[model samples]
Structure formats: structure tokens, C-alpha cells
Target: MKKNQFDTKLIHEGYKTSEYHGSLTPPLFHTSTYTFPTAQHGEQSFAGERDDFIYSRLGNPTVQILEERMAALEEGEVALAFGSGMAAVSATIFSLISTGDHILCSKGIYGCTYGFLEMLENKFGIEHNFCEMDTEEEIQNLIQENTKVIFIETPINPTMKVIDIEMVVEVAKKNNITVVVDNTFCSPYLQKPLTQGCDIVLHSATKYISGHGDVVAGIVVCKAKELADRMIPIRKDIGAIMSPFDAWLLLRGLKTLAVRMDRQCENAKKVVSFLQSHPMVKEVFYPGDFKSQNYFIASKQMKKGGGVFAFTIDGTKKDTQEFINHLEMIKIAVSLGDTETLVQHPATMTHAVVPKELREKMGITDNMLRMSVGLEAWEDIVADLQQALIKSNSNTVC
Candidate 1:
């Protein structure tokens, strides 16, 4: 099947019922270990002579189905599932480089990702350099002989900064470094980084991929068979594989990804428009907005601006708090890409782990708000924001 037909592929690309008594849906193989028919068969499985599952930590049939479906969605050679998004990120990074190697990363990434890299640098001696990564010159200047990987998060968490994937891939190729893109925001429906020459794409499937926000999972999709092969052992040794039930939930989530994302994107566009025109909103950060700094890049690489965007209120941190507190329809939350609209303050919530000075340097200000527009009616979402702004302004004046 052609991978380009994404919506069709989402439902039909991964599993076939003929292998499991024509059940229609993939079954959750809840066993921890698989039994071999004979002693020789078990020996063969251990000796790598037989392609079979031996243990759940190493592999599971249900998890494999989800991996295959995600691979198809991302147009990747293979994919690996993890218990959580951080496991996928850490395992993939550990598999690619040794302790002495250096990594070049985007400045505005997820707070947990930043914390993980810092821990790796301090504990394992792996080095990392963080920069805006908005230009080829910036990337070129940061490249060092010891640099082994270039990691980036486009439409960066909470800030919505869009990085140029193709340009970064070109720079990595020139430097003989691997490029990994954290595609949690766009998912595969909106953007496929592998097709843009990125070596690997990672996702926090707990977000858009699992649209209902019920499961916490992560996946790493590899463009090359060799990279997938290298990552498998690391995942097995770390024992961070996804459970069969979580995999099943993620599989169900994949089926509706195309549809859920379409509506969410539509809602986000309307929200951006409302925020941009509001008097209390100082700046709206959405790549889809024509006035955005990264609008051109977002237009070139993504099908639509994703559901999440950031905006700044024309007031202090207290005003921002008032705005969030006054919000009646939108929920104050950290994670994005859910069925319900969510809002968060990065400086106090997501990026709190980073030093205040560094957070400020990354453009995550105290007054900034990150919003994840949901499947709610656009009018209702707008009205909620309108009233919240009015209430916040009124509170500030009094």
C-alpha cells in the first residue's frame, strides 16, 4: 500500500486478522514469556536461528503491531516502542553515542528533555550544546569535532518555534552527524521528518498519537534498518518496553489520528486568530499565523499548524495567573494534544526544572501561556478566552 494515503494507512496498514483467527482487531498478547514447541525450538530462539518472541521485555506481538503501524505512519524502516517518551529519547540517544561524544540540540525543547541532557552531561560525561537553531550559520558555528548527534524539536514545546528540518539534516550530513527530531507536536499526520532526510523521528505517543490522552507511551522511528537494529538491544537491556495493553491503546489512538488532528488543527487556527486580535494578548506564537517568524518554514514542512501554540499576555506574571484562573472552559494543564483544550504557564510548570535565567534566555517568559486547542467548538473556545482576558484585565485594574 502507498504510504502517502495516510488516513487509509492509519486504519489498515499494520495488522491482518488472518494471523489471529480473523478477529479483526489485534489481540493483546498478555503473556510475559512465549513458549517454544520443543526444547530445540527454544534453543533456536535463543541462538538467533528462529524469529520468535522469547520475553515481553525484548518484544511482544501486540507491541510489534503498534510499532509496525507507527513505522508505516512515519514512513520509517522500523520503530521501537517505549514505556514512556523519555525512555525512547534516552535509549535512542544512548544507542547512538558514547559518553565522550557531544550533541547539538535546539534551545527551546521540552523541560524533561533538557533535564535529561543535563543529567547525561553531568553523570555520564556526554556533552550537549543548546542554541536557537534557527539558521544554518548557527548550527555550523556550534558543530564540533566531538559532536555526534543533532537533536531538535520543531514547534518547540510551549514556545512554538519551528526549526528547519531539511536544513538541519543537510548540516548533519555535511558534519557526518545523525539528526533526531522530536515530532511530538506535529505527529506523523502533519509532518514526517524521515522524508525530509532526518535519520530518526521520536514521539511522545501520549499526546496526539494517542488522541484520547489515556496512555503514556513513546516511539522511535528509524529511517535505516541499521539504526533500528542498534536500538533494539539497548531497549531490551534497559527493559523499558511498552506493555501489551498500552500498545493496544496506542493502536486504537492511531486509527483516529488523522481525523482528530484535522479538527484540532481547525480549532487552533480559530484560537490563534482570536488571541491575535485580543487587546490583552501582547503576542501570539503560532506558526500558522502569517505574522509568525517561522510561518514560512511551518508552511513548507507541515500540512497545518499543529494544535498547540504559545501566547503572551500584556501584563505581569500575576496577570497571566489571573487569566488562567479566570478561564472557565480551558483547563490549566501541562501536556498538549488532548481532546480537551489545555493551558499552561511554562516558566512555572513545564520549564520549571531549567534555571530561571536559562528559561528566560530560551524566550519562555513568566507571562507566556501555551495552549493546546482541542476538539471543542471553535466559538465556545473563543468565548472562553474572551471572557478570561476581560476578567484578567479587570482584576489587574482593580
Candidate 2:
């Protein structure tokens, strides 16, 4: 049989209308436990002799549908859903690392991910180092014997600096290190890290996969089933499974993933152009920009530039806030990949937990702003930025 295209798979890959009362949409199974025909069946389930879902914590029908769909989307063998983005991050890292293990990470990471790494080092004797990973040699230099995992966020969170996945994977493969890429920024619509040789790909499904800001969830897709098996026990023990209702919402959100991302990518290009030409904008960093350092890598791995980008303004932190405050439509929010355009200041808002020195080392600065270009009309979004930049210029601290 011929394979379905990417967009078609997003909507229909893991579901059959006839399986659940002929409903076109996948039915939500909202129960905490599943019934068994006999005590023998329950015993078998507990012993792992049968594949029945024993409890919501272990598995749920609606969540399984989501997992299956995401696995297909990400081109992975298995996918697991989680209660929050941090939960998925925690479970995947814990599954791959031991108390004495070391982790090598990309230079820039989401603030909560930085916090989680800090917690692991302080509490469990696990340690990590952040590297620019500009080349295979740089990644090789940072690797230690105890390094068990290479965790990276391409387009590196708020900075929007694209990393070469194939370069990292090449170095990791030579070292027998497990590579995990955070696919939150691009979602599966624009990028699939597993296809580029990463061992696992994960996302904060609250963003693009949910689209509406109504759900907080995460998903992890592993290239191999052994990795999935490793995470299953961890997710179950940690009790961070996604809710059935959240899975249902994601299912609906995913059906429009392609179209939403298409519009966002187009909108972001126009917004980037406006920001670049604005006198008050010092510089913009987006892989979509033709002259960006890693634009070639981004073009190789991603279908498009994606919806998020960052810029540093010709102003102080106070002026940056003034700009954000003056925006009439774009929101001042930490989260990204939504239908609504959102902006955040990393120095004060999201990356505040990291020390100033470390945040600076991560290329996050007081004058920088990260914006997730939304599904709004490009002209309207640009108008908001124009007015905000004008207001911000006036309020600059001289």
C-alpha cells in the first residue's frame, strides 16, 4: 500500500471511524481504569503477560491515540504523552542518565530545562555542560567519558539560533551517546528530529500541538522501542501521564497543524522583515534569514523557518518592557507556538532563574525579546510591533 502524505497522517493515521460507533472524530475514553473479563486477565495485565491497559497512569485509550499519532508525526517508533513539558523532559532524561552520568547540552535551553538540570546536579550527583556545538569538533571537545546523553534544543529556545542536528548526531554516534532533541519550537509540522538521527524527539504540546493555550502537555517520541520501554516504567513510576481530555484536545489541534504552521511561517517572515528594518531594533536572529549563520543547517533539517524568532532592541530592559507593554494585540507571555502572537523578555521573565553570567553565556541578554509569530494577519502583527517600537524608542533610558 502507498503511504499517506504528512498532512493526511496528522488527521487519520491512528484512528478509524468504524472502531467507535462510526464517529468521524476519535472518541475520548475518559476512564481511569479498564475492565477485564476475569481476575486472570487482571493478573496477566499486572504481570505484563497481557497488553491491556491496567490504569490511566499506565495507559489510557485516548492518550494512546495521541501517542500513536505523534509517533507517526515524528517518524518514531513510540511516543509518550505527559502532564507537562517538564515531566516529559524529566522522564526522558532520567530514563537515560544515572546518578553519576554527565550530560552535554546545547548552549541555549528553555529556562525550566536549565532549572531541571540544576536540580539534578544538586540533588543526584548528575552533572552537565553546555556547549555551542557549532561543529562536530566542538561537540567532541565537550564530551566526557561519563557523558551518557546529548540533549539539545535546536533554534535554541529564545535565541532562535539553529543547531546542526546531523553534526551533533554524528559526534554522538561516535561516542555512543544518546541524542535527544527538543522539538518544541518547530513541532512535527516543520521538523522531525528523529529523522535526522537523533535518538529521541520531544515537545511541549501546549504550544503548537494544542494551538489554543487551553492545555498543558508534553510528548516524547523515541526512535526505537527499547527507549520507549525504558521511559514507560519511568513515566508510570513518576505519575506524570497526560490526561485523556488533554489528549483529545491535542487530537483536534493536530488536525490543523499543517495549515496553522503554514500561515505562521508566512506571517513570521513579514514580521522579521519589519523588525529588521526598524531603527529601534538592534538585530534579529532567525534561521529563516538568508545570512544567518546556521540558515543552511535549518534549511537542511526543517521544512520552514517556523513560527518563533528573537530580536535584540536598541534599548534597555526597561525600554523592552515599555515596548511589550505598549503592544495592543501581541501578548506578553513566556509560552510560544500558539494562535496568538506572544513576546517575552528572557532576562527578566523566562530565563531569570539562570544566573546573569550563565544567561549571558547562553546568549540571552537584557535587551533581547523572543516573539512567537502567531496566526494573526501579518499586517496586523506588524502594526502592533511598529507602534510598540515607536513607543519604546520614546521611553528609552538615556
Candidate 3:
């Protein structure tokens, strides 16, 4: 019943019976069109005078449960689910940005988000500033009269830059700018940005929240009911609505989020430790390391250090490729936050679209490997990395 507890809320918060037997889970309403009782009833539904499901695109019982559950977890007034993470990002930005408006965004945002923002700027006459600096003064300096939004990816992708959400929110509030945080990396289990003053929080549910690689979904959570209502039309018009089947899958995934993230963070800690001590590791970037400059800020806001960390191999690009090629257990992959461990090189993969100079400046190098520690045994993962590192050095002069 309280906001602090996640497991209990995940299982019981969203669903209640709807004119049927008290079932534990909401029934999946699979129909595209819902029949109205009478002509007056249909009219009211069509005219938005009554809150009832008219079409699957507008709303569905099963989808609503997922939305409600996510909203509750994120401490938001409402939520909107999408077919994928990009859909949520697009819908949210499209809802806010108008012609001649400007956006201030973090430089190390997800590659696709950067692309989307650029597209809007180029075509819609909107302006944007991508800054590595997230300090209040840096942000304040960038804000113009037409600045409408301040977007950030705290514990930013690839580079893992931790932004102070409260500080940024405070600055944005003074400027009448909306703040949006991409919570995909931390998920709601570890971080709730709205509680820390973010106006909206978005997640790539395909990652941690789903806890499996089988589905691709996204969710946007916000404190403003009006924003949620506005998003609904865009979601429907753009046809980014999450399928009832995907919603059901996401609901099932939510049941295990707390436990999965617990194990994930545990495994990640071990991986970070191992990487820090390894001779072939250049640097280990995880928020849990207390010695890290960002550790205190991360601890202040997030419940856990999160499950993913970026580490650069103490070698050239060729040597890094050799290590990845020799890995026994950890699979080299693009996406993360699954039941299995995933490793990727952001320079050649996720952030490849970013200009080379910008990528290097963000600390995403060709030799850098971004890992998503999974629910795997710590010892097993370590052993695999040990063997991989050994193989990477077989041809090197001692």
C-alpha cells in the first residue's frame, strides 16, 4: 500500500476485477472494438463524456493494468506504455516540443534519442543543446526564453555519468522548463526520478523491467494527469500502443523485477570488483565504487548501484575484439538487462551513429565494453572473463 515497498505493490497494486469474479489478475480484453450497451452509451463514449474503452488503440483493460502498475511504482500520476522505448521517447518529446522551442539535453543520451532530437530540430525549426555538463550553472547558461525541456540520462548510457536529478529539477523549475529523465538504466526498482523532482520518467522496459529478452516495450510515467491525457492522443495517432499480449508479458515480468534486480546488482558488484583488479582492465565504471566521484550522488538518489557498468579493456581495439571473441559465458550483444549477461562495444554498436569525436569525448571508446551483469553466478562469470583475458594476451609479448 505504501510507495517504498516494491514487491508487494508489483504483485497486487494494479489489477482488480471488472464486473466479474474476483480474479487475481486482470483478464485480457482482446477485442479491437468494445460494444456499447445502447446508442446513448456509444455516443457518450465517442464524445469522451464517459470513461470507457471504445477501441483497443485508445485503451484496454489489460494495458491499463500495466500502465497503472508502472505509474504506481514510479510514483507518477499516470503512465503510457509503448511498443518500444523509442516510441515512448518520441511521443513524450512530440507532446512537449513546438516550433521555435529549444531543448537542453545530456550529451551521453541513448543514440536513438540523440537522433530523434536532431530530427525534430532540423525539420521543426526547434533548437537543442547537448552538453556534457549537468551542473546548475551550465544548464542555466544554456536556457533561453524558448527553452521548454531539460532532458537527461542520469548514469548516462555507455559513459555512466551521474546527473543530480534534484539539482537539475530545481534549476528547470525556476526557468519554467519541464524535466524528463530516461530511467531505462536504473528502472523503477532502483530509482524513481519523480520522487526526486523529475516531471516525467521514461523507461525502455525491454531491458530491466521485462527481465527477459522476449519483449520490446517502453513506458512513460509522469506526475501530470494532463500530460498523460495529451500523450494518449499522440500514442493512438502514432499507433505506438502496447499490445495487450505485451502488457500481459510485462505484468508477469514486473512480478520478478525486485528479485531480479537484487541479484543483478549483486552480480554487477562482483564484476566491478573483478574488473577493477584485472591487469587488462583500463577503468571500471560502476556507481557502487565508493571511491568514485559520482558514488555519493548516486547513493543519495538510487536505492542500488544498478546492474550495468562500463569498463575499458587495457588494450587496443584489436585486443578488445580478441577478448570478446574468446569469452565463454558472457555473450557479446547489443541490448542489456536480460536473464543472461550481455556485453557490447558502444563505439561500434549502440553509440556508433554518434560522431567519432563526440563519442571519444563521452568516454565511449572502441576498447570499452559495456556490460549488463545478469542473474548469473558471480564465480562463473569471473572465470569466463579470466579465460577470455588470457586468450586475448596469448600473442602479446610478455
Candidate 4:
């Protein structure tokens, strides 16, 4: 119809107030375990004959509601929640491949995700390769017999590079490789990777999905029930399941996701425009910007220029840090998707775990700064950033 289905699904999906004594809000089921009516009932649950929850580690009512809601929002067959974004990443990888398998990834990814990939190679025989994924030839050339997963982050972290999801999926389908997309930056509101023929879509629910600084959570949505069935045991055994309260909080966050993301994306465009025109900004990496290399692909994939962007200052690392220090309003922090705008130096902060040479290959330079725009007024954000740039100018000789 009008395409307002998503906004409505965010608030009302997977929740029936009548199921909870007519309470307007979904009641939080905060308990460690569930009691079975009898030994026979417990046996039925343990044997998978009943849908009753046996323990919180395995499942919970509140968490189940969140999972159901997220599945609907992301257009996936099923969804699972995790304690942290890394937990979701680790579990999904562990579930999908064997010890000797290989993974192909986007050149730029979250610093922690990079770390986890390294760990996989070191501890296990599982290896990975990085590709720009710019063309079908490039993707086909990189595929190996052992490559089991094609993991990518579109509008990739720090660099804001947007890969064509359908292009990757098309090549992946030919080889029977699982396509896993990290949708943390876009959230389901902007892009639905599963609908583009991906196998799994993931998110650091701590960011845009939660839309606040308070919660740390993750979600994994699988297009096929068979794929989700494979990951559930991993989540349970790893013991990284999301807490009941976190699920409750996320449900609250999802209710406002459409509004919060709309505001943040709008503010980000205005801020990026100012920075692009500013003298101190040498380069800007925003998916929505017409000048960006990724602009066309992003326009084809994403609904908006997401809330995050990156840029390089026309100065030294010292000058860059000085600019961040001089900001009076925008906070110098690594996390994003909060009500307050946040910024961080990728080379020294979030992506520091990645080796300097490798980080450079990913275009994460010392003078580069990544910002997550918030729900603040566009004028105020631009004004604060302008003042900081002015203060940083004095730190350099020019």
C-alpha cells in the first residue's frame, strides 16, 4: 500500500496486549527459569515436543518477543538475539563454517569484527581474504573451493563504502556460498539485505536498533529456517544470549526506530554538507553525498544516507585530536546511534586493533574521523563542528 508497513510493524508486531491481561505494553518476563507442570511436561520440553521454555539461557518470553519482532522488521524467516554484537558475529561464523573453511570479506569492517576474523585464522585453520567487491569479476576471482561464507559490511564501517548486495548475492548463489551481511550501520529501516537474496543479516542492536547509548545487544536474522536452526545451538552453547531486560529495552527502542533514524539521517546530511564545504575537511565519505564513489550503489540499496559518516582532516593526527578535544557539544566517543552525536578517530580508537598497514589498506588513516549523527538540530551540529575546526587550525603552522 503506502509503504508505511515497516513503521507500524516496529511498534505492534509480535505483541498482542490481549495475551498479557490486556496490558498496553508487553510485560517483561524477567526470570531465570520456567516451571513445568510435571516431569512429563518437562520431558516433552527437553525432547522438543513442547514449545515451553526450559531455561533462560535457552530462551525467554521477553527475548522471544523481540526476536519475533526483529524477524518481521528485517523480513527474515527467523531472528536470534545475543549479548553483544561480537557474540552474534562469532556465533554466526562458528555455525556456518568448519575449521578448515575460508571466508571472503569486505575490505573495511568494524575493528572488533576484524579482530574476530584474525582470531578465527590463528586459533583455527579457518582463513579469510579481503576484497573490494567492486565487480563480479573481482568477486569470482576471489572465490575458492573452501570459501564457505561471504561476509560483508555495506556502507562499510569507517570508509562508508557501499557494496552492491545483489551483485555479491548473485555470484554467491552460483557457488552456493552463504551471504552474511552486517546491517549494523543501516538498520532494517534503511536496507533489508535478506530481501536482496542474502542468507543472513546481522546488527549491533546497541547502535541504531536500540537508538540510545544504554543497551549493548545484537541480532541475527536468517532468511531460511534451516540456517537459523544451525545458529541457535551455537548461541545457546556460547552463553551469549541477550538478557530479558535488554530485550525489553530493545522492544522499546524499536518502537521509536523509524522516528529516531529519520531525525538522525536528516541531521547527518546537513552536517556532511557543511563539512564537505569546509576548508579543513580534505575528504568526506558519506553514502548520500553525490560526489562519493559509493553514491550510486548506496542510492540503489539504502533508503537514506545513514546516521554515520567519515572524513579526513587536512592536517596532522595531532591537529585532528585537537579538533576533537575542542568540540563543546559533540562527544569524542567510539560508539554511535545514540541521541547525542559521537565521533572517534578510527586509526587510534575503534580500528586500532587492526594492524596499521592493514588499516591503511582499508583507508583508515590517522587524520580520518568517523561521526555518528544524533537527533540534535542540524544547525547546532554544524556550528559545533565549525568551532572545533577553527580551534584545530591554530594547532597547525598554516
Per-candidate TM vs. native?
Answer: 0.98, 0.98, 0.97, 0.98
Candidate 3 Cα misplacement greater than 4 A, ranges: 1-4, 17-20
lDDT of 3 by residue, 42-134 (tens): 999899899999999888889998999999999999999999999999999988888889999987989899888888878887889887655
Worst 10 residues of 4 by lDDT: 1-10
Cα displacement (Å) at residue 68, model 4 = 0.6
Winner on lDDT (2 vs 3) = 2
Q: Per-residue lDDT of 1-398 in model 4, one digit per residue for the tens?
A: 23349999998888888899998888899899999989999999999999889999999999999999999999999999999999999899998999789999999999999999998899987899999999999999999999999999998998999999999999999999999999999999999999899999999999988988999999999999999999999988889999999999999999999899999999999999999999999999999988888999999989998999999998889888999999999999988899999999999999999999999999999999999999989999999999888877876656
lDDT, candidate 4, at 397: 52
In angstroms, give how far residue 311 of model 2 lies from its true place.
Answer: 0.7
TM-score of 3: 0.97
Of 2 and 3, which scores higher on TM-score? 2
lDDT of each candidate versus the true structure: 0.92, 0.92, 0.89, 0.93
User: In model 4, which regions exceed 4 Å deviation?
Assistant: 1-4
Q: Model 2 compared with the native: what TM-score?
A: 0.98
Q: Write the per-residue lDDT of candidate 2 for residues 1-398, one digit (tens) a residue.
A: 44479999888988878888899998888898889999999999899899898889989988999999999999999999999999999999999998799999998899999999999999998999999999788889999999999999988988888888988999999999999999999998889899999999999999999988899999999999999999999998989989999999999999999999999999999999998988888999998888888699899999999899999988788777888999999999989888999999999988999899999988899999999988989999999889877776766644
